[model samples]
Target: MPRAALPPVLGCDFSSSPSRRKPVVVAWGQLDAEAGTVALQGFHSFASLAQWQEFLQQQPAWVGGFDLPFALPRELVSQLGWPSDWQACMQHYASMARSEIRTLFKAFCDARPAGGKFAHRATDGPAGSSPSMKWVNPPVAWMLHAGLPRLQDVGADFPGLLRRESARVALEAYPGMLARELIGRRSYKSDDRQRQTPERAQARAELLDALQQGQHRLGLRLLADTAQLQTMAADASGDHLDAAICMLQAGWALAQHAAGHPLYGLPPGIDPLEGWIVTAPLSRP
Candidate 1:
């Protein structure tokens, strides 16, 4: 079968409490698979989850890499007596109050040993991410709580979690997964103005330079104007840089699909209840 034409791609830096001060940042762009290039069109910030959901519903066709966990750990879900199926689990999860989620998850952790308090999904180690059940610190659990429901409501297609629909494909993406590949453990950005130092700015510059120079092994080049590059590098929050990195992952996934890896490089045995992160280095059992 002839491959479908590449659609627009998006990278989203999600926020559970999306406000004017800390909105959800979305990077919009297109991928030129033939040239192995990702041209960043622009960035948009949504001050509320409603606005973000509206945008997703409005877009007819696109592929997106969102910096949010698409599913929880199967162990956690099973322990909580939630559905083991991805879609059903998400639906059940979305219906609960944040307080209830916290209470249940906390109870689970309270029963576990100190060193291994959290139950992790398979993708956590390779992606170097916090467990999806973590409610504090980064609050990735809240991000998942906020983001995945919007995708489900919009009827977006997420491979492994749902059947592949040609209109909109949503993939789980972690900028850290790609960033660590290029710059290992170097702090890049900070939300606190006091912590946003020259060192972090330099790291962002180095990261952008590497992407422009095609230093990443993904074989994709980021096409951004000088002004855009400056803006991305100047952001102390690192949201823009993360979105851009996700855009690259989206490009890579698109290229993978074009090259006939229909699951966009996801492993064949990925756990159905815990979706894998795109472009993460897979570890063998």
Candidate 2:
């Protein structure tokens, strides 16, 4: 059978709050195969779940690389004695607020101070992400807690939760997963203008340069213009960079699709709800 056409591209800069005070930033693009066109479709800051839901309802066919942990480790779930099933597990997680989770993790950590505050997966190092269920630091744990439940509630097709087909695949992605591959532990973003020194500027420029030069395993070139780079640079929140990195991952996924890899070469058995990085597929000898 012939392969399906590549899915439309969606990238998100997630915010757990997602209220008017802290809206979720969504960036979407469409890749036109024949023309090799990757055009920005829209950017939205959704203040309510309904708004986000409405947005998803309109774009049901796009495969999105969202900057949120798609799942908590099964190890954490077994430790907490929560149900192993994805929907039930997320329901339990969605029941708790950020403060509640913070308190729970704090107590858990306090009880085992000698061991350390919280457990982490190996990907956390390269991805520069906090544990997917933790409340502090990068707070990605809370992002999964907040975001996955919504995805579950809406019956969104999370690659970790639902099976992958042709129309949509919601995968967990950290742009840092790609960025760290290029510049490990290098700081490329800062909210403080004074801290945005020449070094950091060069790092960002180099990162963009690498993408333009097709220097990564993805082997995809960024066709973004200088104006787009300036706009992405002006984003102090780091979401724009995250979105751009996700765009790179999306491009890589398209390439993988062309190579006839199932599920875009995503590893088998990643938490169906929690996602994984867009690294090079492990090679067969």
Candidate 3:
């Protein structure tokens, strides 16, 4: 089938509290899987969570990779006596305020050993994602709290979690997975303008070059015009490029689905209450 006939794909770098300065950035594209290419078309920045929700509601059918945890650690959930079932668990989690969550999670971490601070979902180990329970730094726990409820309310088909009748699909993604895979541990972005040094800009440029050259494990080329490429390179925040990384990861999973793996290459028997990160290997590849 022509790529146009397929649903549009997206990679979203979500923000728990978005403002005009730091909006939720999304990279929109179409994947030509057989040809092993992803055409990055444009970017969308939602200044508010409500604006992001509106976009999700309007998308009739699209496969998206979102940089947020879809679920929490099963260990954490069980220990807290939260609902074990995925949907029920989400509902229970969604009911809590951020302060309550931080307090409870802080208590949980405080009880553990010095090195072992937060609880980790299965996917975190393999994907190298920050623990979803971390309320500070990246504040991914807040991200999960903010993003997951919207996804649930939108009624998209969340593979391995909730398979709805709708064609809209969402998968957990970590842009760093691909970045680390291709570029090792080099830091490519920084939120602080002072930290966005020439070294980081060079690193971002190298990452874009690698992506365009299809030098990664997924064997997918990123198609972008000159201006778009420059824009991704120029953004010191790296949100734009992160969104594209997510889009490529989503495309890889979609390719897997097209080739007949129902889980979209996700391992069988993964913990449903702690969702898998798409394209993250169970071990180093």
lDDT scores in order: 0.90, 0.67, 0.90
* TM-score for candidate 1, residues paired by index: 0.96
lDDT of 2 by residue, 161-251 (tens): 6663446566666777677767767888875677877677677777877866667766666666677777666665566767877766775
Give, for candidate 3, the lowest lDDT window spanning 10 residues.
Answer: 1-10
Weakest 10 consecutive residues of candidate 2 by summed lDDT: 276-285
Model 3 per-residue lDDT tens digits across residues 67-165: 998998888999899999999999988899888998999999999999998889888878888988899998999999999999888888889888888
Top-lDDT candidate index: 3
What digit string (tens of lDDT, one per residue) describes model 1 on residues 169-212?
A: 99999998778778889999888999999999999999998888
Error of 3 at 94 (Å): 0.8
Rank candidates, lDDT, best first.
3, 1, 2
Which segments of model 3 are wrong by more than 4 Å? 1-4
Q: What shift in Å separates residue 109 of candidate 1 from its native position after superposition?
A: 0.7
